[model samples]
Target: MKSYLGLIPISAKVHRRQNRMTILCIVFAVFLVTAVFSMAELGVRIEADRLLEKHGSQELENLAGSTMAQTLYPIAAVLTLLILIAGVLMISGSINSTVAQRTKFFGMMRCIGMSRQQIIRFVRLEALNWCKTAVPAGVALGIMAAWLLCAVLRFLVGGQFSEIPVFGISITGIVIGSVTGIAAVLLAARAPAKRAARVSPVEAVSGNEKGTGALRHGAKLCLFRVETALGIHHAVSAKKNLILMTGSFALSIMMFLSFSVLVDFVGYLMPQYSDASDIDISGSGGADTVDSGLLDTLSGMEGVKRVYGRRTSFQVPVEISGAAEGFGAAESSGAADLISYDDFGLDCLKKDDMLKKGSDISKVYGDSGYVLATSDADSLLRIGDKVKIGAEELEIAGLLKYDPFSSDGLTHGEVTLIMSGETFIRLTGITGYSLISVQTTGNVTEEDVEAIRAAAGEDCVFSDRRDQNTSGTYRAFAACVYGFLFVITLVTVLNIVNGISMSVSARTKQYGTMRAVGMDGRQITKMIAAEAFTYALSGCAAGCAAGLFISKWLFDVLIAAHFAYAVWELPVNSLLVILLAVILAAVLAVWAPAGRIRKLSVTETIGEL
Candidate 1:
């Protein structure tokens, strides 16, 4: 008797076509894992080296000892876990299908006095034979992918990471990728291998495979044409297989939608600037740098919609009675920043959608009313409460959430009090505006921005919100998301193609019988197309539903808890993209396999059995 190890090469060579998809699955998983890890490790190392050079080795060591291990390790671990899960699912699906197709072959081996252990070994070794080629190819692909990703990040985004080193092929990444890839393959093969070992010779010869079941009992009952009914019957024949195919397809769609939603939601919740303005012109120097003359000049500019300015005060003494720390020019109150806006400034805030909650500043323009900008939990004073800043006493009018020009700095930190122009003038007796805010009309052109900048002068700073650094960050993140989307999409397409091909290949005899009787190639292609459509419809519907829940959960956990209003918008574009892709995949999957079977003669097809 041939040793199981020796039989593996023969088995793998003979059934190479059947194992092709499984091999590709392993290859893709390993490639992604290695490339991602390599990129991540390289980034960390580069950052660490830069920090060490700038801050000295001791401080760098401390950062590495504390932050690097604490944060980076946890993220790496979680990423590794997710990749492993994906790998296992892909490999297991292929292995399960492979074993189902080879039931008769397994049973014949059993009849030749092969032990259960020998069968298991044979299956595992056959998978390993594919890995020998796949692992090296996967590693090489990973290196190339990492290099490409780095180049894109550096040249395309052009921001903070523009100078950072983006690529390094880490030995650690290679080892982890290779090890996890093989581990996932082995674990996935175990169940199918064991099942193959248990198949009886009698059952195999009788054509009673593990996944097969009773044929369509009542063909006329199906609510479709004969060809369509047969296609549907073929899909539902093995309920487990249907579920597996649909589930895998659904997960791919779900991941794409959920990740896209996360990117959009995060951008909304954590804005780069106060608002999405076309142009933002702030004085580079002190408030004195931007005088009333410049403000008038900017307001009258052609593309400028409105111009506003704010008088800012820092570390002013305040007294909040009944406070735990007895706030007095402290970080909680007076030491915090204060912004007083005129009526025009108030209008600008409203136009930019920066107001969270409060009546118009017009209501408190000349009154003693004040708006407190602090977290609800950490608020020292409530609405209607009187507080004394220096000599002027003011009542808390309302609460303002995160705003761009606040003491809390964009999202959260220290508290600031906002008051009307008159109230601000009457209280601190200051009259100069510190920050000049500008809003331009729709899609400000480069000439408009240059004109503004020229008017502001070289000494005074100018910013076009359209060209903010946050845009670079957003693009980088979006690219990363789309990269993941691409990977999952490729995997999904492969799964569909492999699944359809395997199903059609297994039914060669049935197709031959139909062709011999009367059915044409067009009818055969239509039947396969119908089957693919059913699977795509079922999978996409289920996936969209799951994606919505995931997006909401991600918003709640990542965004809502951190900042303000985490609204869950429908991922309409993402849904449309997923639907279109699924449809295309279904068509390609069915068309390719059906075309092959259609060209074969009845005798040649039946002879395949």
Candidate 2:
């Protein structure tokens, strides 16, 4: 039972710059988790409410409960996990730097009979104290950020955000932020703690940084382990850095893992949506009530192939519980499905890759909410769920995920389904198609989409798959996420490389001593490299597992927020690619820094230390 006071010395040991970096990372992590989760959830909730509360709406309670009743836990999980990892690394980095400076102090402690356990306990306390000071503050600051966001959203949409918490004062938010922050801090502290406790009293008192001859030791040895004649020797190590080094490596791995998973997951799912065609067409209404017949007429008059329907709408209205009052209160909030008519149904046409998203609603709905959807609407809509229209609710059966790469509009993701004439009339009291898709009757070699547009007239809109731009939206978002992750990874790699470098620096005299006693620079380099390798390998494995779990959760948040959104179509190579890449990078990042170990002057280095 160590006194909390014990944390002071450890705290004193941490560098201010490193501390601030950790704090910033925590802040960003908190912001990312809270913002993404809350926005997606709150937005979908509002979309549902808007539909039902409007005149002629039905199925208010059942639809709302069923649709909005998914989990926010996954969102929380991803954010917490990521933030936790980052925090740990930052703490670990600080600890490693500190221990390098305080190496001798620890040696002195050991000489005085302070046990390794005691030193380890001291470092832990120091880490705990820092977490106590930093994490809570970050959580609080994250919470306060609501006002600013609310003001901004309100200004943009007039009244689409609530002034209050959408999920009850965000208590869960604060708790999560704090917990993750603390967890990260602790995780990063391991390496520094371990190394700081193992210093020898002799090394501590001598102050003469000299080369020592290494005798090998057995089975489980220290950081630098080798299977040699003297068994495996304990070439004196640092206690303070034990925690720091571990933490930094772990965090870096986490970053690598997170980014790789996200990319792989997204990459896996995007192609499933490919329509394989160069053009698709849609309109306001037509025969069979599925294709409006307009696209069929035009394409029949020209070149095209098989066309079909796609799920083009998944919209709902929700009274956002925790969002600000006006956060989702649209001046006129309602729902509609984007569809393509024909045996070539909207859903089928999507299979053909012929949609120019929102083109169906162009003339009638224009860019206005009355017909076209606003990017604002996308924040509130889902892709496969049902949206209420007047007295009827159109099931969003098939539609591309709402994203700007296609076009900015509510209709982008939410499609007003073109159902069986019987189903449509029975459900919506409407017996006409909202849109249609036309297939090229022949080779239909029109690569220029606009040329087909002339044939489509105002009756239909068309696009082809060659350069149809299906990957744009998905790639954009993925790029942003990966780019952000990349920056974090870069920082993490630098920290890791530096930590390893410092590790070698501190052990200069030890290396010199070893060389004097018969150990060569190559052997010493290998030893140091082994230490860095451990960190990299451990970091990567842990990071991959963590990143996958987090990415899955984030995907779920998208699903929960959007009633009918399909599960992301993950690719086969996703997991394999990510794992391999991260592990490779970790190895590479450490390689250069560790390689320099052999470059040190054996005699001079040993003598100077």
Q: How many backbone clashes does every candidate have?
A: 0, 126
Top model by lDDT, which number?
1
Tell me the TM-score of each prediction against the true structure. Answer: 0.68, 0.49
Residue-wise lDDT of candidate 2 within 267-316, one digit each (tens)? Answer: 44454343445555545353333444443555554455654443243343
Pick out the ten consecutive residues of candidate 1 with the lowest summed lDDT.
405-414
Q: Which ranges of candidate 1 are over 4 A from the true structure?
A: 1-4, 39-82, 151-163, 198-211, 214-216, 219-222, 261-402, 407-474, 553-568, 603-609
Candidate 1: tens digits of C-alpha lDDT, residues 47-123: 67667778888766566565444544444554565556656766776787777678788888889888899889888
Superposed Cα deviation of residue 1, candidate 1 (Å): 11
Clash pairs for candidate 1: none
The alpha-carbon deviation from the true structure for residue 576 of candidate 1, after best TM-score superposition, in angstroms, is 2.7
By TM-score, who's the top model here? 1
